[model samples]
Target: MNKIKVMQVVTTDKLSGAEKVVLDIENNLDKDRFEALALCAGGELKDLYEKSGIKTYVADLSSLKPGEIKKFRSYLKENPVDILHGHDVKASIGAYIASKGLGIPVISHLHSSYPWLQGASPLKYIDRFYRKKYKLSIACSHMVKEHYLNYNKAVSEDNMKVLNNSFNFNELKEKVILPKKEMRSRLNIKENAFVFGFLGRLLDIKGADLLIDTFNKISKDIPESLLVIVGDGPEREKLESMVKNYGLDHKVLFEGYQKDVYSYLNLFDCFILPSKLEGLPMAVLEAMAMRVPVISTPVAGVKTLIKDGFNGIILKERDEANLYEAMIKVHSSEDNRVALAENAYKYLVENYNIDIYMGKLQKIYEGIR
Candidate 1:
């Protein structure tokens, strides 16, 4: 029997939640039974994918342009894949169009519940049309599955399934081995500082600004505190300006888009994600796998991942006051921090391990094939 050939199509080159999912599938797919490849808009991820020995193709799949679709269609004609697994809307749309009459199954993997999919947006109807064309739609969380079912009545339940984001604990364990003191020194962080870290795209939806506001309120309370932000995006300059305005220029460090975030996760005293929206965040899982305590606003899938005061802190409200209290609570006790990390790590081991995810994903791919 021939190995299943899968091509994961992504719109962006940056490393974020959805992009990381594509990488995970590419790296961990069963080599004996499957052959994984990537088609990306071309950026940092392209290099990373190639370096990992996966064949990666560069193309702007973020648009519905005729040339872009033709490029994808042409590529499929020359070197066909069993599955064209497209991540998110644009890439899925491109794949849906390009794979016409090619007999290859296009899998739409949704990573978030976008606002455009609600209310009376034209995009929602357009999305509804293309969604039904796919062999299957994989929602990153149950929240995303419900969101689509609620608004897009045309989509059948039989055609969709929920698969949460997962992490490879084996790979994670290796990366977290770097000495904490060495990592802190490289980033100019004090050994004893209470580091509150955020790692993701610096976008408004991610609420990096809200995190800054919450940190600004409590920075004075915790004098030896540092807010280290890893990852970069359109909001970088805006967020940096906000930090400067709060006089947190010295206290805040923006370690723009890191290829190796596990090293940073290993050093963080606590990981904070103040996102206003999310499907299921990969950063939180990475943090949990690193055995780092987490504090996050109750976004889409966060409520499922964290239990307030249990495995991690879940903010009741997305405001400076609540976040400030949560930060202070964690800062006040070392025992609380250790307990949170332990529970989080255990929860990750039982629930979101890569084997569970890969098993389900491969089943979906084979079912479609």
Candidate 2:
């Protein structure tokens, strides 16, 4: 089969969900069926995109400036891209203009629950204009799809599809020849202390503060348990203050970003993702693949992944009471915790595997003209 030259456009190269998904597709996708390329707002991921043998382009469209439109449009005409796929707002608009009248399809992938698209921004009025210009619109989850539907002036629900926001599983043995003790010693946790971990940007939207409050609530019960938070963002200072305020200074340890997260995944007894919104968090998927039971709020993509009591714990409220109650229940029961972890592992292997997720994308690529 002749490969379809598919170009994925992203607004930035931040090492997060969308960029990871783009790399997942580039790595696992069949080269014979798809010639993958990327056009991103330049960053650390540029080398990886280029090394994948995918042509990488950078058009730093400050998200405004009419010149970005002209430059991206001109690039499309000269390069003759097969499918112009956009991952964020600027890229969506850029792809729309660049692919104009060429019959090349543009796919807009909505990966967030941004309120601006739902009548919050004055720009919502022209949403239909950009949405309809594309050959396809993809949401990372159903919640994102419904959110966009409310403001989709030109495109219908029938035109939008939900694509994968998957985590790429590493094939290292379940027990790597890695040292849990060294990592634990480095973090200053006792060799035998119970550890509950959270890994993501320490942003307000990610609910890092809520995690601290919840841990505080159950601190007496899990007195020996240590909380290991592993990321940094704007809310880091606020969260650090809140943790101290709750008098969890000793129990809660904030370890900023680590290059290889998997190095620390197994050190924790459980993984927590307390977010206000989401597009299928890769961190949650990583936790599952590592057989760590996940306790998270009912965010978009997460709501569809597991039942309330089945594969994972989905809390209705992100408050101290509810989150702590859920955590206590899971922590109190070893059998239940193991059951949930086993189920989560099965779910990732069966459904969210990179190969299965990217195969669906390849089929979508083949369907486009």
Which residue runs of candidate 1 sit more than 4 Å off their true CA positions?
none
lDDT tens digits, residue span 1-369, model 1: 899999999988777788888888888899999998989988778988898788998889775789978988999999989999999988998988999999988999889878777788877888888988999998989888887788889999999989999988757655636678889989888777989999999888899998898889888999999999998899999999999999999999999988788889888999999988888999999999888999999888888888889999999898888999999999999999999999999999999999999999998888889
Backbone clashes under 3 angstroms, per model: 0, 0
TM-score of candidate 2 to 2 decimals? 0.90
What TM-score, computed on C-alpha atoms, does each candidate reach? 0.96, 0.90
Q: Write the residue-wise lDDT of candidate 2 on 75-147 in tens digits.
A: 8888887898887666787777767798789988888776676555756765567877678888888887877
**How far in Å is the alpha carbon of 288 misplaced in model 1?**
0.3
Whole-model lDDT, candidate 1? 0.89
The alpha-carbon deviation from the true structure for residue 278 of candidate 1, after best TM-score superposition, in angstroms, is: 0.3
lDDT (Cα, 0-100) at 14 in candidate 2:
59
Off by over 4 Å in 2: 151-153, 170-179
User: Ten consecutive residues with minimal summed lDDT in candidate 1?
Assistant: 169-178
